[model samples]
Target chain A: MASHTNENTELGKLKQKIAGLEKLEQQHKKVEAKLKTVNKQLQASENQLKAYNEQLRESEQKLNQQKEAAEQSREFAESIIDTIRQPLLVLDKNLRVITANQYFYKLFQVSPESTKGNLLYNLGKNQWDIPELKELLKKTLPEFSAVEDFEVEYQFETIGHKIMLLNARELLQKQGKERLILLAIEDVTKSRIYKKELERLNKELEIKAEELQQILYITTHDLRSPLVNIQGFTKEMEASLNDLKKLLEKMQIHPAEEKSLNTIMDEEIPEAIHYITSSTTKMDNLLKGLLSLSRLGRQKLTFRKLDMNRLMQQVLDDFEFEIGKNQVNIEVGNLPDCMGDDLQINQLFSNLIGNSLKFLKPEVPGEIVISGGRVENGCRFVVKDNGIGIPREYQEKIFGLFEKLDPKKPGIGLGMNVVKQVVEKHNGSIEMESELGKGMKFSIFIPD
Target chain B: MKKELKIILAEDDEGHASLIKRNLKRAGLMNEIIHFKDGQETLDFLFQGKKDKDEIKNVASLLLLDIKMPRVDGIDVLRKVKQDEFLKKMPVVMITTTDDPREIDKCHELGCSNYITKPIDYDKFVAAIRQLGLFLLIVEVPDLNNMI
Candidate 1:
């Protein structure tokens, strides 16, 4: 019985040893699978970190490019402002000049080498002193756009104490804390002098116009009586005489009278007689026309719708005598109409047509065409004539008084002047277009 | 063309009228000459709304006119004569010292036959009157019965 019990105990001990070895093998396999999974996750996270680092580096490069472009644009703008050949200066918040162009130095008659570290008031170019200019700049900076011809005036002995127009504005930036003022100066001495001269000339012209009017009246009053007496004596001699021999004998007794009579038959007497009548007639007409012009200036215009073709036809009728004499072929083109004056406008057409007839070259066929069109706020009428063309340099001067291009034509050179005055009275403009052989086209614009 | 010829002169100035009549007589034309001093008497004899037979017998052939005269102007007489059908054919000459071409042109346009501006000197005045005598030869002066 003792031998059987000892065998069972040995078998139990052997089974326990086998079970312990199997548990040890299973634990070793579980640890190896976890170690493989952890190694794969670590490799994925390291690859993602490398890509993120590259994205960060690219963003930094783009920021560097943007900063460089902005800096280059600022430098370019500053250099462009500096390149101008006028006196230019930039000041900081302290009222001291931060920078100045070479022109500023030259205009002030101060050397840039000497003025580099100096204040703005130290330079001779300043009209308003630095303190006043700074105050003006501060007040004007916000509303400078509303002001035109704004200037700061002061006297400077170094630049001969002339007037100046000063312009100033401040430059603002988001990143910069300090503001800069840019000042520009223009010398207006010549313009001021020119304005004074123009005023003086206008006053002189007014006096001259009055004097001419007085002289004209005096001349007409003095010339009328003598002309009437001359007509009376001529009629007496022709009557109660019949013999050629007696006439010749009587002529022989008065040698000087014969010479004078011969001259009267030739040129001077005929011309003098014609001129005297014409001068008297012109003065009367001028007085009447001038009164009309002045009246028109003061009164408001009454505008009416007009037919350009009908108006032109009426103008053509007033020219019947001239047309018959010259045998001219007048043409008309597409005519347009708008709201404007009728009577004064009629005078305008008459003057133009008369001028066309008067300026015609002798023995040459005459041609005149009227063209008209509608435009914005106005309409245009053109009288194109193939009579004689004006010189290019003289075309602009034709509208002024006493500017006669042709002396052979009889006029006081007042017709075109009257036309111009009338046209301007209508708030319009007139332009002359011509080439040497092509003749002239005078365009008239009358506002609606 | 030869008939009993007569000329009547009416002038305010005696010197101009006498010299004029003398120059005409010296031109070798034989005509009965009568002189008057003003337009009133001349117009009365020619017109005055009366047509007497004996008074018409002394009617002259040519009428010399001046624009400026007392009582009635010469232009007024010329106008009346021109409007009168029986007297319209008579040649009227306007004589003056003014060299106003406009007035001359106006006179011509008004149907005056001829015009002459007088010479300033006396001798030239005679010469001018004599030359006008030659012009009268060219222009026809109709008889009173034939004119009507």
Candidate 2:
């Protein structure tokens, strides 16, 4: 019985111990379930953190793209400002230059350091301190939103006098939050000088025209009065000789005396009268030349389209007799039409061609060529003659009034003078090229 | 009183005056001629300033005036003479070497009786003087002293 109770106690104890272990095991499972719940919560928090990290990275990428775009736009705006041709400047409201373009640096002959951030009127050795510029920027531009074509005339040491047209615009800078002045400068000195020169030339031309009228008056009246008297006295002397001749014819005379009277009347007296007549004729021709030249000054020019080819043909035809006598070969080349007075041009060509025909060498056949074409802002005509060329000593004087190369010739020596006058009337120029015993070439340039 | 009409030739040039006198003789104009060297002398001879002023004033006369003269021009003399009522009807003829149309028109505007340009051609000049001679023979002269 004692052995059996002992066994039973031992079994109870063991059973109790086993029950405690089971309890411990159940408690451990509950603790493990709670731990699983906590681990799931931790995983959920980590996923949320990863999503937050991705969002932060995307926002940072977007920020970088915006920054790049802003930089590119800024660069493009600066390039646009640089492309303007005129000198451009950006200044603060205080008239301090904030920035200047490359043209501004070049035009003012200054570096960016000297120009930028410097007072606009105190730059480049105070060359920019012009009262007009100061007045415009400080007073005029501030009063107005924009100043256009405000002229500032200043003298620069390097560039001499300069006329600058300033254009200014008042602008509000959006980013910097400041008032800016946009200044543009244009140089117009060349055009201003051209206008001044043109006015001066016009005044000179008016004075010259007045003087020409005075010359015409003196040449016509004062010079011709004495010539008329000489002509009248010669006629009186001839009448007296006729009466003396009749008286001598009625008287009976010795042979020797008759011979003496006949010689005196026929040879000596007739020779003397011939010289006087010829001299008077020459003087009369010279006076007529002067009159014609004077008349040219008063004549109103009638401008018309003139066909040079047809005119040359007509001029050549008019000289057919002379040409035939001289056996001259004339070549007419391509010629351009010109605007001129027909009568004066006809007279000019007549004199020129007549001179060519007159000066032809006796030993050789004459070659006369009339040729020309359009040139720079004008037409050029060349009259080349293979004839006796003018001497170098007489070349300059040939165009003078009453200048004669050959006194024995019948011409009054006014042909070249009239030619020069006519050329001047047409606003053209004639230049002679010659070498003695070689040839003569006259080139005429007439402006369109 | 039958006073002969005289011709008064006012010329600065002596040769022109001689030519006129000789040509007038050739054309049978036998009138006595009085010559003046300049415009001032011509003015003095007329308007009763010269020694023979009374004789010249009593006679019927014609005045031939040159446009160009020393001291005073022919236009000034014409202006002075035409301004005076007594000398206005003196029948002045303008003789000049200048055939400028402006000068000719100016002389005609000044009441010149005739305008004659001294011709450079010998035959034409003599013919022009002869035409003047023929005109002198026919034109009637008013007696100034009788009218006064």
Candidate 3:
């Protein structure tokens, strides 16, 4: 019985041992599954961390590019402000200068250190604080969003007197940002002075012309009284000489003495009287010409549309006797109409035609051509004559008073002067082209 | 019988007055000519009678007035004479050196009977004086005292 009890005890011991071993194996498998779950959670956490790091690096690179672009734009704006030629200023809402262009600093004679960030009125010891400027900036600019050509005349300390035309623009900002103003300055002092000088010269010229006219009128009128007396007294002396001659003829005297007396009456005394008479007549004609010339300034001009063809025909008809005598051939071309005084224009053409007739070359049959057409601003008429032309030396003096080209000619040197006066009165211009012994041409332009 | 008509000549220049008197005599005008040196003298003779001259109450007279005189002018004399009751009927002729048409028109507008421009040429001046003499012979002279 002892042996049987010992065997059962040993088998029961082995079974218990085997059962413990199986339970241990199951616990080990459960530990391995927990480790696998922990490994999966660690892999998920590593992926999320990598994604956050990549996002942070990308954001840093974008921020650097944006900063570079902002810096470039700011530089571009600065370059634009500096490049303008006119003095330019950028001001804040308080009218304090934010920045100034290089031109502004140079023209105002102010350094950038003293100019920038200072109130515009306070700059240069308050020299820019002008009433007109204050009115424009304070009152005019706010109502008008933009101000153009706001003139301010101020006495500056450095520049003396300055006339500035200010143009301002309000640069509006969004989101309640500080508003700025763009001020552009133009200096018009030199141009204004030049204009004033020109006006003064014009007035002085007008006064001089009026004074000349007055002098001419007074001189011509005062000379006539003495001329009349000289002519009348000359006639009286001639009558007295004639009476003395008759008395000597009736009385008997010594032959030699009578011969000398007759010679005195016939040759010397009569010759002197004849000279006096002719000289007086010539002086009378000259005085008459001067008087008429002075009167031309006061004559009323009646402007009318003139038929140039008819007028030219009338002028030719007036010269018909001379034309026939001179054997001149006149060609009348198509003449354009123009507005002018009738009597003055008639005188102009008459004088020209007469001059042509007088200066005709004897060797050749004289040829005169009158042609006209509409020019750019007026009517242009050409009077071309194949006649004795003026010498180049005398050409410049032909329009002056009492300038006669040909001494042998019968005129008193007043014809050409009258022609010039008539042309000036009509506000017309005349140009002459001539070569000695070749031909003469007159081109006249009269406004339509 | 008509009283002999007396001619009153008003001139400023001595030479012009002598020449005019000679020319008028040559024109066969034998009428007595009374000369005055200036417009003032002529006015005094007509308005306030001269101390040495007879009273001009019944005198039949004609006036030849020259313009451009000292103290007073011919136009003033003409205006005053034309305004007067007795002197207005007396024929007045304007003789002047000025040939300006405006002065001639002004003389006519001021009631001068005739206007004549003195020619500088001696023959023309004699012819003008002769024409004036002939006109004076034909024109009827009004007595100053008889006119209203």
Off by over 4 Å in 2: A1-94, A99-213, A299-448, B1-4, B43-61, B83-86, B141-148
- Each candidate: how many clashes? 18, 0, 0
Most accurate candidate by TM-score = 3
Which tens-of-lDDT digit does each residue in A1-448 have in candidate 3?
A: 8878988898888888888888988888999999999898888888888888898889888889889998999999788878877899989888999989998988889989998889999998898888887777777787886999988888888989988899998888897798788899988899889999999999998788777876775676556556566777888888998888888879989997978887888999889888887776777667767766766665578899999999989889989998888788999999989999876788799888888888999999999999999999789999999998989999988888898887777767887889898988888999999999988999999986
User: TM per model?
Assistant: 0.43, 0.56, 0.64
Q: Across all candidates, what is each one's fraction of true contacts kept?
A: 0.00, 0.66, 0.24
Off by over 4 Å in 3: A1-89, A100-115, A123-129, A153-164, A171-179, A184-198, A297-302, A305-338, A353-397, A431-445, B1-148
Chain A TM-score, cand. 1: 0.50
What lDDT does each candidate get? Answer: 0.69, 0.84, 0.84
Stronger candidate by TM-score (2 vs 3): 3
| Cα-based RMSD of candidate 2 | 11.0
How close to the true structure is residue A133 of candidate 1, measured as C-alpha lDDT? 59
Q: Write the per-residue lDDT of candidate 1 for residues A398-426, one digit (tens) a residue.
A: 88876778775666576788789779878
What is candidate 3's TM-score against the reference? 0.64
Ranking by DockQ: 2, 3, 1
